[model samples]
Target: MSGSPPAGSQQQGAVPNPGSPGPSSPTAGNSGSSVLVHVAGAVVHPGVVELPSGSRVYQAIAAAGGELPEAAADAVNLAAVLQDGEQLFIRTKDQAAAVPGPGAQSGAAGAAGPPPGGAVIGPTAGTIVDLNTAGLAELMTLPRVGPVLAQRILDFRRQHGTFATAQELDAVDGIGPKLLASLLPLLRV
Candidate 1:
């Protein structure tokens, strides 16, 4: 027989090569790529979680120790794809009720109104700013959107045309998932 070990056999105390894919190696499975998401609100353990890329909202919730008993499941789209740096807010039943109903363009009981010339719906349904038509001043009114970021948003819109969806803001620099979540309820096509 040739001077060689049989198939699947290796020398005693032998170690895998550095470049080889071991059983625990990330490349051996789908564990290598991951997306960081921040899950807050009515979760059992709310915090940032690193989930496999392409994970959904439900998965992120599970990663955050699953939702609390008071979690308003109906308020969230659990099947929604999770994006890196995104924040998933799990509202309670009361908080869910605070969200405005459809076509609620204005009039939130005991809620603060939107800025001048802006329409307020409810606590969750903030003013709707059209991405296509909002000027620099209007854009700057968004949470965490300062002059520089608003200018960048304008520049992006100028170069790329109107945003297809609020998530498209992620394409603009300085806008991460947390910021996008805050801006989503306040934006229109």
Candidate 2:
């Protein structure tokens, strides 16, 4: 905000460091806290890395040494931004397609919806719902699920643990045989 530019100042047009104080937006969410995160899968340096709490999606990718050629960079909602304790799954095309169904959970951008582990549908990028942690509305995002059924699933989860298998979705209140059949590919826990 100073008046005249300094002479021969080649750094005038340079990009500012994100770490430096510049413009702070009250609504620009990011934790000032710093934490170490493990970045793996298709990344340049697939290992443990440290980053600030509210770093952008791209910043975390940069700290991870950037994405590998096979990583689905386009799939991430980079501009929606990031949060602390978040996991980024830079999944390969083959890796994503191998899941029961990809692109089903579009409710939350940049949140991992595909499972990180091969055995279950992951929170790889979209809304990741823990059967125990989610409320009715949150649970409805799953395929073939609705408010009534989501509540049943929650009640069941409260009485029991996560559904031992997707088959147990049949036990939920409104989940009839046809609905359970419809949900086979989506219900993981």
Candidate 3:
């Protein structure tokens, strides 16, 4: 009885049934509604950062690397309020894309097969990666795709539209039977 809470107090050692939903369960600002935010990129730490309401973009910048020398001064509204899930992009001065050169239309490498020794087919069946959402870096990972061909793939997708079928990649200048064969399994709409 000594371990029990006194009258009018909550019972000692009683576990609150957290699974039960009450009116407060689903309401914002309730005990279950607390959420912390993370900020990265061009900032001081470039890692997890917790912020409360009224935190500003400058705060995240300070948490990262205090901003790179080439980070656009005008890119971020230093005083702007940071949203809970916002990710800020600060471009660097040297991170510019150069114009394409000759062989920009060089054909795709034909029929990329499994690693070790190349073949027309892969050891395990291929899986598709979406071109629409994939970045230039990702497309470059494909076999025989030099930087130029990767850019062309992005440009073609942007000019036309998302690729529904993997076969549609044949539309890109460099993509041929060889390239398509390798890319087929790795593509998704």
Compose the digit string of candidate 2's lDDT tens values, residues 109-173.
23444332221112443444555454443354355453345556767887888666778767776
- The best candidate by TM-score is 1
Clash pairs detected, candidate 1: none
The total number of steric clashes, by the backbone 3 Å criterion, in model 1 comes to: 0
What lDDT tens digits, residue by residue, belong to model 1 across residues 107-158? 1212322222221111233547778766544464455555467668889998
In candidate 3, where is summed lDDT lowest over 10 consecutive residues? 115-124
Task: Please provide the root mean square deviation of candidate 1 (C-alpha atoms, Å).
Answer: 16.6
TM-score preference between candidates 2 and 3, better one: 2
Instruction: Point to the candidate with the largest lDDT.
Output: 1
| Whole-model alpha-carbon lDDT for candidate 3 | 0.44
Per-prediction TM-score to the true structure, in the order listed: 0.45, 0.42, 0.36
Runs of candidate 2 exceeding 4 Å displacement: 1-32, 100-189
Better of 2 and 3 by lDDT: 2
Instruction: Give the CA lDDT, 0 to 100, for residue 114 in model 1.
Output: 29
Backbone collisions counted per model: 0, 12, 17
Give me candidate 3's TM-score against the actual structure. Answer: 0.36
